[model samples]
Target chain A: MNLREVGLRDGLQLEAPIPLAAKLDILDAVAATGVRRVEVTSFVSPAAVPALADAEQLAAELGRWPDLAFSALVAGRGGARRAVAAGMADLEYVISASDGHSLANARRTTDEAVAAVPDIAKLAHDSGGRLEAILAVAWDCPFDGRTAVSRIVDLARRAVDLGADELCFGDTIGTTVPGRVTELLGRVREACPDVELGVHFHNTRGSGLACVLAALQAGITKIDASAGGLGGCPFAPGASGNIATEEVVYLLEESGVDTGVDLGKVLEAAAVVERAVGHELPSNLFRAGGPNRPRGRG
Target chain B: MNLREVGLRDGLQLEAPIPLAAKLDILDAVAATGVRRVEVTSFVSPAAVPALADAEQLAAELGRWPDLAFSALVAGRGGARRAVAAGMADLEYVISASDGHSLANARRTTDEAVAAVPDIAKLAHDSGGRLEAILAVAWDCPFDGRTAVSRIVDLARRAVDLGADELCFGDTIGTTVPGRVTELLGRVREACPDVELGVHFHNTRGSGLACVLAALQAGITKIDASAGGLGGCPFAPGASGNIATEEVVYLLEESGVDTGVDLGKVLEAAAVVERAVGHELPSNLFRAGGPNRPRGRG
Candidate 1:
């Protein structure tokens, strides 16, 4: 039930400009809710992700929160170097499972992406930072038909061998169900028993929480969730973002899994971001209020 | 894995005006997909539900789908009479388990609602129609904080005693999670072993499909879903519709459950309804397309 709040990175990636100061305010609020780990920003091109142009500034500002561990997203060697330079000692690197999305998104074949992993890892190690590899579209690929379990396992094994601190899989476009999640995670567990596994899910097709439950059952411990489900795939049109943090926390706590997040306070933080965004964010708990809070009051 | 499509009844209770002609078209599509049962409409004052104003006409048009057992929703004796008179032989008589919703929606206490069920059952049965006593808000009530399993089971027992042919429980407002679903279904199974059970769920809080999986594991053979997720709870503000039919069919078929519905075709029908409503429907399969279909056709 230990979940990483990914809203600042995943949620902001799909939106318009969010000031670094406003994002800092969000980070401060999230930290107070007892969510220790937060993916703060991605070191992608400012032109590509103008919303996260302040990645370096954001990561630098994060030095103020000594109790919280903040990470940044990086897609390539250059981005990894930038993330390290920005003072982000922890990095989540991604490569797509789908051939079409892989070529279109990162301009590389699967093998090329795998080859880049070691280089990125080496750079991170030399820079005194750590790297986590996340294979996107690990279950069902929107551009390809079905992503083979063998392929994802191979990627995970290679990533771990290449010095990845953790291996996370993404249902990039949310096409996965519990069966697929269990099947893939089972394979991952069998092949790489010692590596920590995390699941990153999108609620685009609405199987996000179901996938979380499946991942938990399959013996995986970590999950990636957005606050208000604010991220969508920049490469895949119509693709939505990661699961909401509030929704995930509610599910985890209700199932007797300890998420260590205060639901009411998290919802309040989500509300602040929603108001800052000028439209309702996709977080369900923020909209519906928490389990104990009355809907219309405060 | 028999799915009971309830879009016309539960889905239409919201603001979406799935036209009567489109309703029949969707019904025809559902029947063609090999669904065994479809809840066509609720025989209420058209004033309350202008969407189903042509309920009588729609039912008459569905006479040709002999294999699809049509059902209608009824809240009281008058609605039951209207359904029977319109040639619907199966009436789903509903009462909320929560006293607050029972009093607000039906203008009766929980006890009074239970007391009235017998007469309504007799009226429908005397007219050669079958009655299915539906217990709404079975998992968690939006009005009355948390509903007890004993209260639901007792009401279910009394309903069966009064001549209910089947029992259906709604995850009203979509507050149900997998653990809660397991506990609630276990209570019902313990209380009424022989009673055929059905599940009606909403996707308001994003756990509908997981709840469906839990229900299936609990040995529930029947489920309720809406096409394109058109329903909303008037009492539970901001909640979405029932589980989308396309998404449920995808999950069931992907998981090796024989739902007997061509999920690809179901998405086609969902697309039509989505277009008719002049807004993109919330159904995952409709937007993401089916897994087996060729990758970019959708």
Candidate 2:
């Protein structure tokens, strides 16, 4: 199974702006954990998200680890151009399924966002890059309440038809449960059978890891997690960080699944990010440590 | 499906001692949430568990809520006698399945602990109380590592033969995953088919709720949870609280499983406990609020 680390882009987007040097240190720690794929940063407007304003410079530093596979998140044609210009061949474009989150997050309607995806996909393909369309708020929306499964299925089909190579579902508010995860994966897969699928879940409501388990049971291998469980939707109030990478690794590894990532190194990386963030990250494994440690009286 | 609130006993056993007044207030809040059963306190030695030193006083206050079914935890004959004397008809007796933890937590071998159950059960039955044998460290032990499923099965049979009204497996150090949860439940059920089965899981390894899901899917309904996610084992190092009640209710209610408890009232009760504890509880739902709350840009 492939575990993609999104702590840099999705995780840091909500925190106060740290220096480029700190970002490099975190990236180095992340790479040292043997996580080959990382969402390095986003090409969003610098004024909108100052935390990731140094996306280009950080992307420039990717040459330090030529063996790692790096991807960047983009919102539109302009961001896509910047990602490709920075020599990144894998771009993730997010389109919210709910119009409420769409307008709030992308400043456009869901249809308008979908319309922009075809051009972005063409740009990515023309530049010999791969485009992954991430359907945000695919299960439940903050403003729209429960999202319609048909909306996600329709978007998945459209993204696949628009030359996108992969698709993912983002539980934007972390309100989804395992049943909904199974149903959505079934519907999306029925509609777009051959597309590689992934899931991005936040631990907002405590079902994040449960939903991840359901996704894995449904045969999904690509999972998006943040180091130290960093990152939340700045637009979604009460939302917490994405599922912690260290916790996910521990869960999968303990279940006899081969993640190929060093659990200790991941914890080390989480410690580095936690120190950089200057607060406790929302990772139970990071806080509790691993299972093999010595037991003592509390 | 029945959800038993163990925050007062299991949750508070790790926190600094709070007064009986605070405990009563928390109980009132918990009863208001429509939770019918609660493990109010434990009858262990005060020197061993000073946090629950007021077991007699706490049990005496149970008359305030006659509609709620209350239980107390006991380690052996002495604690069970105290529980019955204090007027609690339901008693939970804990026995460690692994000898390593059995020696540490109960200061006896697993066989010696099991041998005490018949006398405790006779006392409980003679006093018109029911005995729930809680098998601690059923899946993994801190010192002994992964416990043999046969050990748990053997103990379950012996506890049932000794007149245990119900059986529960305690993931003492919280090192279990969902697959292990399913396997243990299946094996134990195969051994004791007619006995009521439940699970007590710690979120120590980040799989508590997932294990809950697995147990629920495996046809077990009763679950043990802590309010505000407070509590950890003093003997089990690095272990956190049991699965949070609010998170369990949220997961069940959102998934169409009616837990018969009001989510809002549980959060209010959690708020009261959080104030009494003077620290953040580990419940993600308690911290994030319910799913229907308003959303705003961060």
Best by TM-score: 2
Tell me the deviation in Å of residue B290 in model 1: 5.9
- TM-scores of chain A across the candidates, in order, are 0.93, 0.95
Q: How much is the lDDT of residue A209 in candidate 1?
A: 84
lDDT at residue B244 of model 1 (Cα atoms): 84
Give one clash count per candidate, in the order shown.
Answer: 2, 0
Off by over 4 Å in 2: A233-239, A294-298, B233-239, B294-298
Candidate 2 per-residue lDDT, tens place, A1-298, comes to 8999998988888778999999999989998998999999999899999999999999899999987899899998899999899888889999988889889888999999989877898888887889999998888888888899988899999988888899989887788899999999998889888999999988887888899899999889899998878877443322477888988888898889999999999999989998887877777777776656532221
Candidate 1, residue A75: the lDDT equals: 86
The TM-score values for the models, in the order shown, are 0.91, 0.97
lDDT of model 1 at position B155: 89
Candidate 2 A-chain TM-score: 0.95
**Residue-by-residue lDDT tens digits, candidate 2, B165-266:** 999888877778999899999999999999999888888767889999999999999998978777774333223767889999999998999899999999
